[model samples]
Target: MKFIDSAGVEFNCPVTFTGTVTTTPSSPATASYMVKRWVSPTITQADLTGGQASQSVNLTGFPGGVVLAASYLQTTATSSSSNGGTTGATLSLGISGSTQAYLATGANVLGAAARLSNAAGTLLGTYRASDVPQVTITATGGSPDLAHLTLSCRAVVYYLEVTAES
Candidate 1:
């Protein structure tokens, strides 16, 4: 049973989930994983050349009220051209907004109306329909022959809920 407003008003709190990623250095240079609406064994498309590389994955469609904590690179490359290299990756997470993309604080947080965050546990920004979250990886450190290596990731999902109003 539930209450109503006017004739029978009802509101939904929202569904949210959060998580992080960590990378490290390894041999053969291969990475693949899935998160949110993204699946593993995927490839990233090159912006300049429109070429696809087998070292990227994307997640989509959140059930609202989801928040991502953090994403650390234990051992991974930022670009496919520099895959399997000694360099580190600088990753960026983008959230969906009404007409623009918002960057998250700590990791990636998906909430009602589509929002993002990376502030360790705070809401970084919000998004609306037609907008989607994007993750970018850049390379740093000593460069190695990463052309032959593959990319992959291990995604972790988190869930939280609010029982009563305070």
Candidate 2:
């Protein structure tokens, strides 16, 4: 039988314990505590204006943690008047001003969809929930005309929170 003193743990450790003997001591190895979560914020069409040459995919609700590989990006743009001769796009994603840390600049953002996976691991530091990671997508190549153009963008960021700093 396993015993728990005071019927509680310091960090809310697991109550049940595993042992090979029928008798056990009051104190046992306490399991480490850690919490992990994910947050994805998307910038909708309503958030953007009709005429624009460049824009940032900055949103809110993300957390401060080590970014994971499962992060994803989805965006689509259409123009009511004209596509603005847009031919190419430059995408940069990272923590704050360091946009090239995670995803390097000119990373083919206009190619349907994009993702931030471990394959291209460039993670540097932890992010804050209040300041959802920023991904600046600057239209480049050809002549990008945002007049009467509606663009919708969305990004899903994954991260892990650990108890001890690694």
Candidate 3:
């Protein structure tokens, strides 16, 4: 089969699975993996108007389960020196709530241009299913950011649904 893109919309590629792929036996299909789409708002000057801006997604899944993986895909490039400001702009992605830093990987930071999944400098550790998921962008180069006009992108969250007995 082949992956299909929606009309005028696309992205949020699935994470590449490698190594030993294990699927344990369980009842009620516990420990099963899943993915969710999180369409983000356009990263515009307003987001960085005050030097920072952000978008987020509240994940819903089994409480005892864990987030398997997460990624960001920039579909439409920003105007220039994008993301938030003309320069010194950075982005971060990870789980929200108490475990905010659970996936604070620099690999997800938006670069000089609109960055894709910056899943580096950190490990995708125990991101609890009870937590929310999202991304935050900041600007350190200008007052009332003007260069970051339009940045279109989406994110994908992979999770495992689990139960205590499973």
Candidate 4:
């Protein structure tokens, strides 16, 4: 089912999902996962468990709302440049974004320094130019290959508004 308002008003319409990055190359870079929309401000990761990959979310508390679009990314880390593409190595991860602007891009997001925080709100990674936001994975020239780069991502959308009827 589609997530649309009968009154046709523009709402923030936010969604979220969590999944491990697939090791296979057949996996799409941006997998369209589904989410359960809630009227409340917060939705836990457990809310999306057992749901299908790229499935359209169903609204419960927010019954009237519709699920429109989804956005997320997956990345795999590669061996250091010194290695001739043999082993996988873990590297420091960073992400930058605007706490204020969800659509911020490039230096704009980077400048804001809005980054990913640990569950406690501690900064685990800082957003950098190399880390692709929503779709990209940053790498150093030819030294590191992002082949099978694995990372977790969460996407959120804000519902702009809602109407009683479509």
Q: Rate the local accuracy (lDDT) of all candidates.
A: 0.32, 0.49, 0.44, 0.26
Off by over 4 Å in 1: 1-58, 66-86, 94-121, 124-133, 141-149, 161-166
Candidate 2 lDDT score at position 123: 63
Instruction: Report the Cα lDDT for residue 115, model 1.
Output: 26
- Local error of candidate 4 at residue 79 (angstroms): 14
User: Which tens-of-lDDT digit does each residue in 1-166 have in candidate 3?
Assistant: 2333336444466645575444445422655544433344444444444333344433343233554545554535543454433454445555554223433434323333454655431425444645454545543454424345344444444445444562
What range of 10 consecutive residues in model 3 has the weakest lDDT sum? 102-111
For candidate 2, the per-residue lDDT at 120 reads 38
* Alpha-carbon runs more than 4 Å astray in model 4: 1-101, 105-134, 162-166
Q: Compared to the true structure, candidate 1 yields what TM-score?
A: 0.31
Per-model TM-score on C-alpha atoms: 0.31, 0.53, 0.48, 0.23
lDDT of 1 at 132: 38
Ranking, lDDT, top scorer first: 2, 3, 1, 4
Query: How many residue pairs clash per model?
Result: 43, 1, 5, 29
Q: Point out the higher-scoring one by TM-score: 1 or 4.
A: 1
Q: In candidate 3, which residue pairs clash?
A: 107-118, 107-119, 107-120, 108-118, 108-119
Q: Give the root-mean-square deviation of each candidate in angstroms.
A: 16.8, 9.8, 10.0, 18.6
With candidate 2 superimposed using the best TM-score fit, by how many Å does residue 115's alpha carbon deviate from the native? 4.8
